[model samples]
Target: MNGYRFDKLKLLVADDNQHMRKLISTIMKAFGTTSVYEAESGEAAWQSLKKIGIDIVIVDWQMAGMTGLDFVRKIRNAPDSPNPFLPVIMLTGYTHIDHVRLARDAGANEFLAKPVTVKALMAKITSVIENPRPFVRTKTYFGPCRRRRNDMSYKGPERRAAPDAIDVDGIRPVGSGKTGSHGP
Candidate 1:
């Protein structure tokens, strides 16, 4: 709240649950957000996104018309999207590691599990405003950089290269192709 000017920001809240929408909106207003939009489903949210000047999006994971994960994918990869770089905060009841990874892979800038608290919501908002992640474009993905920060303490060989090191042809360096045999 120190540097963030919530009064000037425009936010869109997308959720199928009416009560959830109202609750989030109320919290947003309490946090000094003056302009907030609501959508009942992902389709409706997409429509609003096309028409409004939204600074941030808080979308639930499950919806009627389209899932939140799909919505985020569309926003990040769709050629007709109004703002591909728009910051998105994903809200989901599923707090499992798989769900979090899915949200991240879908290009969500932040992830917030359900049973939302004012403190967590405000923290996420502040993070998006104060420390925005850089957008990255690759053959398989086109959204915010997946890596949060560089680990300077690790003296071993670089596990991942910097985003700037990516080639102009949208090629990302290949990592170890091993995948864990367990879990979702």
Candidate 2:
């Protein structure tokens, strides 16, 4: 494990459950985080974000007013957002493949299932601190690059190589207007 100065980092924990918030705060404190903020809902989280200079955010998926996914989307796409480049770690009990994909698509930097352990939490924190992903800006998405790593060994056809690559306007690229001889 790398030696990180967690005490110097300002983290925000957003969850509706009081117990969950305390638990996460306790765990983060144990990890040496001195400045940890807690929010009871997404709206509160947003307010805190606007007021505090937080380094990282750990939010629950289901909140009272706004869900974690919605919060992430707003953070990534909202023009008035304080820090669009802020790193967010989503915590939820929904561990299904679809749920994971949904969180990723919603612009979460990392995902952690509920009933989290210290080890898992620390690993995610370290990963975010050490190997942060590059941000990608598109018409519909503005967050960390969705692709985690390149799989060179795969033999599947390249998705972006086709003329249907999504451009800034949601249509195909300009030069890709001509259809292939195969079909329209």
lDDT of 1: 0.78
lDDT of 2 at 42: 96
Candidate 1's clash total is: 0
Write the residue-wise lDDT of candidate 1 on 13-106 in tens digits: 9999999999999999987889999999999999999999999999999887799999999998888999999999999898755566577778
Error of 1 at 122 (Å): 0.6
TM-score for all models, in order of appearance: 0.81, 0.81
Instruction: Give the whole-model CA lDDT for all candidates, comma-separated.
Output: 0.78, 0.78
Worst 10 residues of 2 by lDDT: 164-173
Residue 100 in model 1: lDDT? 62
RMSD of 1: 7.6
lDDT of 2: 0.78
